[model samples]
Every structure is written in structure tokens, then in C-alpha cells.
Target: MAAIELRNIVKVFSDKRRGRDLLTLDNINLDIEANDFVCLLGPSGCGKSTLLNIIAGFEQATSGRTLVGGKQVERPGSDRGVVFQQPTLMPWLTAIDNIAFHLKLKGVGKAERHHRAMEFIDLVGLRGFEHHHPSEMSGGMNQRVGIARALLMNPSVILMDEPFAALDAQTKLEMQEELVAIWQKRRCTIVFVTHSVDEALVLGNKIVVMTKRPGRIREAVNFDLPRPRDITSPEFNDAKRHILALIREESTRLAQAS
Candidate 1:
């Protein structure tokens, strides 16, 4: 069974200023299998984040249905972990505390929470920095803390919204590799949203291309490229070429409409 399912998802926003409605998503039907690293790829404002949010139960679609783990998704739950574009960590909380925040919310005690979160702190490579606050850490480091916090929940599905978009190239690449490694060992479903073709190609086993708003699926290309992928490999370039053409067409069409 699919870990997460969206059947004919539709989202419409009221635009009173224009005296009209804005259709943001149209008939979005997607089935993400368990342990798949699926990237929602598209240009900016294509409702990629909106789709992720719907699945996360942070935002509601105007119509249609979303199911997570064979149950209807009516609201957010600890089962679905979300890491937004920014690391929205509490400034005053220490790294370990931040990672354990959810557990704390569940009424888990201090010692137990710290013990459970320590493993993730080390997992995200923030061992010594556990005592530090969000302001005391670097951008990448804070993002790691954010990720660790999500993982500490042991979520069956993790939703990411361009989590690395703000990082420097080197740091972003490092995070990508680390994330891949984490997914490999943990075996959890991940839906990552990004606009960069290369980023999606490098990270996702399946790439779900989306169109301009009222975002619809353009293509769902599956990649067989081996892990620790060589970006310059012939097979990699061939796949890139196909994805780029689709993206180029999308950009042109959106530009004309706007």
C-alpha cells in the first residue's frame, strides 16, 4: 500500500481584491510508496510547498482527499514530520532540547527526552553542539538540528520544503549526501520539494515534475541512476537533458501566461 496518497487533490484560494478565485492546485493525484525519496520538482510558485503542506495537514485543500498510512489525514500528527524552508527552532532552547521538543510535548520527562534526542544529535553530526542554542550555531548546523528534531519523532514520512535552499553550495551538497545516507539506513518515506532540476536529480529516486499554478503533475520520472551518482556520467547527463527540456517548456509557458 502507498504510504501517502493524494487523490484528485484541488486547492482554490479566494481573491476578494480581484473579485475572483485563484486555483492553486488542480486534480493532484500522487501515490508515494514507502521509503521512496520523492522530490516535487517545479518552478517557484508552482504549489510544490502547498502540496507538501496539504500532506502534512498544515494546510487544507479545497477539495479531494489525502490519506497517510491508509488513514485519512484530517490534521497534523507526530507521525508526519515537517522541516520547513527555514529552521524554525526555538532560539532559547539548546540543540538537544530542540530535538526533544516533540517528546517533551508528549509529556516525556527530561532525562528520557535528552537520552532519546542524543542519538539524533549524533546522527546529524551535532554531538558537541548539543549544548548550544540556535543563535550559537551556523546555518547548516541549525538545519541539521531541525532535521534531527524531525527524525527524533521517528516519523513514518518526512516532509521537506527546500530545506537546503538557503545553505551555501558546499554545505548544501554535504547535507544532500548526509540525507541520502540517513534515508538509506532508516528506510522512511521522504517528500522533498525543490525547484532545482539538479538538486532533485541528485537526491530523489523519483522526480515528480509539476506545472505552473493550478499546479498539475507534468511527469513522474523514475531514476535508475546508482547512488553516490556521478554528476558528469553520460547516463546522468541524458536524464538531465530530458528533465531540462520539460522544465524549459514549463518556464516559457508560465512566462507567456504572466
Candidate 2:
């Protein structure tokens, strides 16, 4: 069974000033298998973020339905963990506390919460910084904490919305490698949203590209490049060429329309 499904989903936002409803997502259908790493890739304003939010249950679709683990997603829950673009950690909470906050809501005890969260902290290589607050951490480090917090929930699926977009190149690469390692070990399904072609290529086995606003699936491409993937490899270049061409065409079309 698919771990996540979106059937004919649509989203429209009211433009109160313009006095009209602006369509953001067209009727969309997607099925994500359990343990799959899927990336939603497209140019900015393509509604990829909106799609992620719907699956995360942060926003409701205008029509159709979204399902996670065979249940309709009406609201956010611990079953689907989300890591946003910016590290949304609680500034007032220490690293360990932030990671354990979900457990706290579930009525887990202090000693147990800290003990459980410590494993994920160590998993994300945040070993010595458990007691540090968000303000004390670098952007990448804070993102690591955010990831750790999501992982501590042991959710079946993790939704990441451009979670590394704010990091420097060096830090981004490090985090990507770390994330791949974590995914390999954890076997969790991930739905990652990003506009970066290379980021989607590096982290996802399947890539779904969508159209500009009022987004519709342009293509769902599958590539089996071996890992750890070599960006310089001939196979990698071939795949990149194909995907880039599709995106460039979309860009040109949009530019002409405007």
C-alpha cells in the first residue's frame, strides 16, 4: 500500500484585493510507496511547497483528498514529521528539550524523554550540544537539531521543505551526506521539496516535477544512479541534462506567458 496518496487534490487562495480566487494547484494525483524517497522539484512558485503542506496536514486541499498510512490527513500529527526551510526549533528550549517536546505532549516522563531524545541528538552528531539553546547554534547545527527532533518521533514518513536552502555550500553538502546516511540506516519514507535540481538528484530515487502556479505534474522521472553518487559521472550528467531540459522549457514557457 502507498504510504502517502494524493488524489485529484486542488488548492485555491482567495485574492481578497483582486476579489478572485487564484488557483495554486490543479487536480493532482500522487502515490508514494512506503520507504520511498521522493522529491518534488520545480521552479519557484510551482506549488511544490503547497503540495508538501497538504501532505503534512498543515493546510487543507480545496478538493480531492490526501492520505498517509491509509488514513485521511485532516490535521498534523506525530505520525508525519516535518522539517521546514528554517529551523523552527523553540528558541527557549534546549536542544534535548526541543527534541523531546513531542514526547512531552504524549505524556512521556522527563528522564525517559531526555534519554530517548539523546539517541537522535547523537545520531545527528549533536552530541555535545544537547544543552545549548537554538540561539547558540549555527544555521546548519540548528537544522540538525530540527531534523533530530523530527526523527525522535520515529514517524513512518518525514516531510522536508527545502530544509537546507539556508545553509552555505560546504554546510549543505555535509548535511546532505549526513541525511543520506541517516536515511540508509532508518529506512523511513521521505518527501523532500526543493527547487534545486542537484539537491533532488542527490537525495531522491524518484523526482516529480510540477508546472508553474496552478501546478500540475509535468513529469515523474525515475533514475537509479548508484550511491554514493558521483556528480561527475557520465550517468549523472545524462540524467541532469534530461531533467534540466524539462525545467528550462517550463521556464521559457512561463517567461513568454508573462
- Give a tens-digit lDDT track for model 1, residues 104-194: 8889999999999989988889989999999999999999999998998899999999999999999999999999988898899999999
State the C-alpha lDDT per candidate.
0.93, 0.92
Which segments of model 1 are wrong by more than 4 Å?
252-258
TM-score of 1: 0.97
In angstroms, give how far residue 147 of model 1 lies from its true place.
Answer: 0.4
Please write out the lDDT profile of model 2 over residues 1-258, one tens digit for every residue.
799999999999999998999899999999998888899998788899999999999999999999999999999988999999998888999999998998899899999999999899989999999999999999999999999999988999999999999899999999999999899899999999998889989989999989888899989889778779999999888888999999889879989999
lDDT of 1: 0.93
What's the TM-score of every candidate structure?
A: 0.97, 0.96
